[model samples]
Structures are given as C-alpha cells and as structure tokens.
Target: MRVVVQRSKKASVTVDGEITGQINSGLVILVGVTHDDKEADAAYLSDKIANLRIFEDAAGKMNLSLLDVGGQILSVSQFTLYGDCRNGRRPSFIDAARPEQAIELYETFNRFLREKGIQVETGRFGAMMDVALTNDGPVTLIIDSKDKKA
Candidate 1:
C-alpha cells in the first residue's frame, strides 16, 4: 500500500462532468495498492495518515494532526502511483493491483478512515476522474507500508 498525502484547503473530484466528492479543508489522499497488499497494509496507512501531524498549530509549527484540526479527507484511487518507468519512455503498471483487488482494498482503506472518525470522501474507483485542490502549504508526503523497518 502506498499513499501520497497532501494538505489542502479545499478539493473536489469530478467524474464525467459531475462532481463525485468534495472536501472543505483537509488532506487529499492519492491511494495505491500493489498485487501483494493485504488488509494489514491498509490498516497501517490509515492509522498513520489519520494521526500525521502536518497541520500547523497556533504557534505556526506543524504540530497538528488531521484529527487535531478536524479536517476532512478526499481519497482518490490512483494505480499510477505504482507506475514503473525504469525500462522505457512509457510507464508500466505491472505492480499495480488488478481493479477487483484494488477496489476492495480502496474501500477498506476508506472504511478504516471513517472508523477513525474522519470525514472521508472519495473518487469513483476505476473511473477517470478530474481532481482539483488548493494545496495548503503545498505540504505533501509519500508513505508506503512496505517501508516499515520492522
């Protein structure tokens, strides 16, 4: 499991010219899954992201977590995060999970976030989506479940 988390003041996703999901102030999460990803991976990332302290506090320090700031989440499924371009000009998505598996984990991930008491919105899985966001602080971070030292 991999996720690109971006702090945003506002964000929305449009599918076929219709807005599917939107958020006022929160993180826009681009989520990806690989062939071997398991429920544990989804669980790990959901907890990590929910508690990540990227939002600034009153002292202007990045000490506030999404939970602390009562922020929303706009989660988008993005298999492209697994794109591999090491071989040629074109990228290969061989590591990305199949749509069936991807969607299952994607929904599980959102469910995990919701269980954490965060307001989570999402783009349509397997749909071509146009996402728009005002990236707050332009603060972005990439997290991968496989990177855990343990």
Candidate 2:
C-alpha cells in the first residue's frame, strides 16, 4: 500500500461532470495498492495518517494532527502511483493490484479511517475522476508500507 497525503484548504472530485466527493480544510489522500499489499498495510497507513502531525498549531509549528484539527479526508483511488517508468517512456502498471483486490483494500482503508472518527469522503473506484484541490501549506508526503517494513 502507498499513499500520497496532501494538506488542502479544499478539495473535490468530479466524475462525468458530477461532483462525487468534496472536503473543506482537510487532507486529500491519493491511495494506491500493489499486488503484495495486505490488510495490515491498509491498517498501518490509516493509523499513521490519522495521527500524522502536519497541521500547524497556534505557535505556527506543525504539531497538530488531522484529528487535532478536526479535518476531513478526501480519499481517491490512484493506481498510477504504482506506475513504473524505468524501462520505457510509457509507464507500466504491472505493479498495481488488480481492480477487484484494489477495491477491497481501498474500501477497507476508508472504513479504518471512519472508525478513527474522521469524516472521510471518497472518489468512485475504477472511474475516471477529475480531482481539484487548494493546497493548504502545499505540504505533501508520500508513504509506502513496503518501505516501513524494510
């Protein structure tokens, strides 16, 4: 499992000209899954992201977690995170998990976030989506469960 977490002032996802998910003053999470990912990876990321202290506190220090700021989450499925371009100009998605497995883990990840008492919105899995966001601090981080294990 991999996730690109971005702090955003606002964000939304549109599918076929219809807005699917939106959030104000929160994090926009681009989630990706690989063939080797398991439920444990999803669990780990959910907990880490919820508790990550990236939000600014009163002292202008990045000491506030999403929970501390009562922020929402806009989770979008993005298999492209696994795209490999080492070989050629066209990226290969061979590392990405199959749609069925990806969707299952993706839903599980959202459920884990919801269980953490966070307001979580999501984009339609496997759909063509257009995501828009106003980056708060332009603070972005990429996390991979494989890296954690190593």
Candidate 3:
C-alpha cells in the first residue's frame, strides 16, 4: 500500500460533472495498492496518516496532527502510483493490485480512518474523476507501508 498525501485547505472530486467527495482544511490522499498489499498495510497507513504532524501549531511550528486540528480526508483511488516506467515509455501496471483486491483494501483503509474519529470523504473507485484542491503549505509526502523500517 502506498499514498501520496497532500495537505489542503479545500478539496473536491467530481465524476461526470457531479461532485462526489469534498473537504475543507484537510489532507487529500491518493491511495494505491500493490499485488501483495494486505489489510495490515491499510491499518498501518491509516494510523500513521491520522497522526502525522504536518499542520502548524499556534506558534507557527509544524506540530499539529490532522487529529489535533480535526481535519477531513479526501481519499482517491490511484492505481497508477504503481506504474513502472523503468525500461519503456509506456508505464507498466503489473505491480498494481487487481480491482477486486484493490477496492477492498481501499475501503478498509478509509474505514480505519473513520474509526479513528476523523471524517473521511472518498472518490468513486475506478471512475474517471476530476480532483481539485487548494494545497495548504504545498506540503506533500509519499508513504509506503512496505517502507516501514522495523
């Protein structure tokens, strides 16, 4: 499991010109699942992301977690995160999980976030969607469950 997390002031996703998910003062998370990703991976990431202290504090220090500020999440399914372009112009999606497995884990990841008492909104999985956001601090980070060093 992998995610590209972007801190945002406001965000929304549109499908077929209709708003699907939207949020204010939160993170826009692009989630991806690989062939070997499991529920444990989703759990780990949800915990880590909910507690990541990327938001600022009263003293202008980056010390507030999303939990601290009561932020929302705009989650988007992004299989292309696993695209492998090492040897050719065309990206290979062989490392990406099949839709059946991917959607299950993706829902699990969102459920874990909601269980943590955070509001989560999500785009339609496997849909052609349009996402827009006002990136607060332009702060973004990439995290992968497979990179846990323990």
Each candidate's clash count = 0, 0, 0
Model 3 steric clash pairs: none
lDDT of 3: 0.98
RMSD (Cα, Å) for all candidates, in order, is 0.6, 0.9, 0.5
lDDT of 3 at 50: 98
Candidate 2 lDDT for residue 111: 99
lDDT of 1 by residue, 63-146 (tens): 999999999999999999999999989999999999999999999999999999999998999999999999999999999999
For model 1, the superposed segments whose C-alpha errors exceed 4 Å read: none
Task: Provide the clash count, candidate 1.
Answer: 0
* Residue 96 of model 3, lDDT score: 98
Cα lDDT of candidate 1 equals 0.97
- In the range 1-150, model 2's lDDT, one tens digit per residue, is 999999999999999999999999999999999999999999999999999999998999999999999999999999999999999799999999999999999999999999999999989999999999999888999999888854
**What TM-score against the true fold does each predicted structure earn?**
0.99, 0.98, 0.99
Q: Weakest 10 consecutive residues, lDDT, candidate 3?
A: 83-92
